[model samples]
Target: MHVVVVTKNTPDTAATVTVKGDGTIDWGDSLVVNPWDEYAITEAVLLKEAHSGKATVLTVGTDEHQEALKHGLAIGCDQAIRVWDGALDGCDSLGYAEAVAAAIRKLGDVDLVIFGRELADIATDQHVYQVARKLGWTMLGYVAKIQALDVAARSITVNRLTEYGTQTVRSTLPAVISVVKDINEPKYPTFIGIRKAAKAEIPVWSAADLGLDAAALQPRTQQLRYQELPKREGTVEIIEGATAQEKAAKLIDRLIEEKVL
Candidate 1:
C-alpha cells in the first residue's frame, strides 16, 4: 500500500485580500496549506498505519511552499517531494494536473493517489479527473468514506457524496481519489513530528526532472490584475407607528422609498 497525497499552498483564508497596482490579488505575505489537502494527508497517514506501508506527500509550487510540505510531513508522511520553478506561477488546473501526473509517473509503483476535492483559492475541482485522464487511472471524486481495501481483489470500495445522496463505488487499485471535507477529520502535527519534519530534506523536482515539456504545460489563464473588495456600508432606519398594520405599512413605504421593493 504505497499512498501518495498531493498538496498545495494557498493564501490564508483569514488574511485580508489586497489588490496590487496591476489588479491582481496581492499575496504579499499570506500563505497556508489548502484545507482540503490536509484531509488527504491525514487520510494517507491513517492508511499507511493501517496497511503498514509508506505514505509520501508531494506538492508543485515554489520554494516558499516548502513550509506547507513540511507541515504535511510532520503530520506523518514518510517523505516529501516538491516541484518548484518560476514557470509554475499562474499555472491553470490543466497544466497543474499534467505536471502532477508526470511526477507520479516518475515515481512509479504507486498504488494510490489522493487529492483534496478542490483547492480553496481556485475552487477548481478539475485536477483529480485531469490527472486520472492523463494517467489512464481510475478516478473517484468527492469520496466521503473509504469502506474497504481489497488488496487481493486489487480494488477499493468507497462511498461518494453527491447533491442528491451518496453512492457506493468500487474502483481498481492504482487509482486517484479526491476526498471531500466531510470524509474525515484531519489531524494536527505533534511536537515530535514537527521537529522531525523540520529536519527532513524535501527532494525538489523541476519540469525537466519529471520529463515534462514546458510548452505542453504552459498556463492558459492569465491574471490581468488583483483588486480589493469594496468596503461594506451600514445604514439604519426607524419608523414609528400607532398599530401593527401601520408599522407594516411604514416598513413597506420605507422599502419603496429606498428602491428595495
Candidate 2:
C-alpha cells in the first residue's frame, strides 16, 4: 500500500493578499499547507499506518513548496518529494499535471494518490483531474470518506459528496482521489515530529529527472495582466413608512421601478 499525497504551499487564510501595481501578487509573509490539503495529508498518513505501507507526500514548486512537504512529514508522511525545474517557472495547470504525472510514474507502484479538492491559493481542482488523465487512472473528486482500501486486491471504496447527494463509489487501485476538508480532523505536528521533519532530507526532481522536454513544459495559457477589481460604487437608502404594510407597498413599488419585481 503505497499512498502518494500531493500538496502545496498556499497563503494563510488570514493573510491579506494584494495585486501589485506591476500585475504581481503579494501573498504576504506567511505560507502554510493548503487548508483543504491538511485533511488529505491526514488521510494519507492514516492509510499508510493502517496498511503498514509507505506514504510519500510531494509538491511541484521550488523551496517554497518544501513548506507543505515538511508539514506532511511532521504529520507522519514517510517521505517527501519536490518536483521542479527552471523550465516550469511560468507553466499553467496543464504543465503542472505533466510534471506531477511524470513524478508519480518515476515512483512506480504507487497504489493510490490523494489530493485536496481544490487549492486555496489558486482556487481550482483542475490539476488533480488533469494529473489523473495524464496518468490514465481513475479520478475521484469531493470524497467525503474513504470507506475501504485493499492494497492486495487493488481496490478502493469511498463516499463522494456532490451537488445532488453523497454517492458510494468503488474503483480499482492506482487511482487518484481528491478528498474534501470534512473527511477527517487534521492533526497538528507533535514536537518530536517537527524536529524529525525539519532534519529530513527531501529530494527535488527536475524536468530532466522526470524525462520531460523543456519546450513541452511551457505555459499553455498566458495571463495578460491581473488588475484589481473595480471599486464597488453604490449608495444605501432606507425605505421609510409609517406602517409595515405601507413599507411593503413602498418596497414593491421601488422594486418595480428598478425592474426587480
Candidate 3:
C-alpha cells in the first residue's frame, strides 16, 4: 500500500494573536504545525503499520514549510515532499486542492490520500473533497474510526461521525479520507525518529513541476478586510425571591428589558 498524507503548516493556537493596523493577523511571531494536520499524519502512520506500506507526507508552502514536513517525518512518515513557490503564497482552498492533485498525479500509483478534516489557518474542510472531485476518487469525510482494510478486495471500511451518530461506509481503494479530531491521538516524535528525520532529504517542487498554472489558479476568495473580535463584557444580577412564580416573572421582565424575549 502506498499512502499519501496531506499535511499543512498552520499558525500555533497558543501564540497570542496580534492584529495589525490593517486588521490582519501578525504571524511573524506565531508557531506552525497546528494539531489538525498532526492527526492526519498519525492516521497515515497507523495505516502504514497495519498494512506494511510506505507513507509519504506532502505540504503546499514555502521552504519554511520544511519545518513542519520534518516534524511529520519525525512522527513516522517514510518521506516528505514540499511544494513551494512565490505564486502559491496566498492560494485558497481550491487552488491548494488543484496543486495537491497535480502533485499526487505525478507521484503515481497512490493507494490512499489522507488529510485533516480542516486547516487551522483557513478552518475550511473543502480541500480534500475538491481534490477527490478533481481526481475522480471516492471521498469520506469526518472519519472517526477505520474498521478494516480489505487488501484483496481493494476496499476500506470506516466509521464516520455525524450529528445523528456514527455511519459505517465502505469504499474501494484509491480514495480520499478527511479525518476528524477524534480519529486518533497523534504520537510524539521519538529520539531515533527525530535523528532520522533530521538526516532525511526533503524534495521541493514548483508550480511547473506540479503542472499548475499560477494565473489560472489564482485565489477566488477575496479578503476585503480583517477585523479584530469585539471585547466581551457583561454584568451579573441575581434575582432572589420567596416564590418560584415571582422569580420566573422577574426573569421574564429582565429578558424583555434586554429585548431577548
The best candidate by TM-score is: 2
Instruction: For each candidate in the order shown, give its overall lDDT on alpha carbons.
Output: 0.87, 0.92, 0.87
Instruction: Determine which window of 10 residues in candidate 2 has minimal summed lDDT.
Output: 218-227
Where is the poorest 10-residue window by lDDT in model 1?
222-231
Candidate 2 — which residues are off by over 4 angstroms? 235-261
lDDT of 1 by residue, 1-261 (tens): 789999988888888776767776667567888988989999999998998988989998887788778988999999899987666667887788888998889889788999998888877788779999999999999998999987668899999998889999998998999998887899999999999999999999988788777786788777665556676777666778899999999999889998989
Candidate 3: regions farther than 4 A off: 236-261
Report the C-alpha lDDT of model 3 over 1-261, residue by residue, as the tens digit: 889999877778777777889867777645577578888899999989888998999998776678788888998999999987777878887888898999999999798999988878767788889999989999998898899987668999999988999999999988999898888888889999999999999889899898798775799997776677887777678998889999999999999998999
Shift of residue 227 alpha carbon in model 2, Å: 2.0
Ranking by lDDT: 2, 1, 3
Which stretches in model 1 have alpha-carbon errors above 4 Å? 86-90, 228-261
lDDT: worst 10-residue window of model 3: 25-34
- Find the candidate with the highest lDDT and give its number: 2
Instruction: Let me know the TM-score candidate 3 reaches against the reference structure.
Output: 0.89
Candidate 2's TM-score reads 0.91
lDDT tens per residue, model 2, 77-192: 99999998888899999999999999999999799999998999878899999999999999989999999988888899999999999999999988999998779989899999
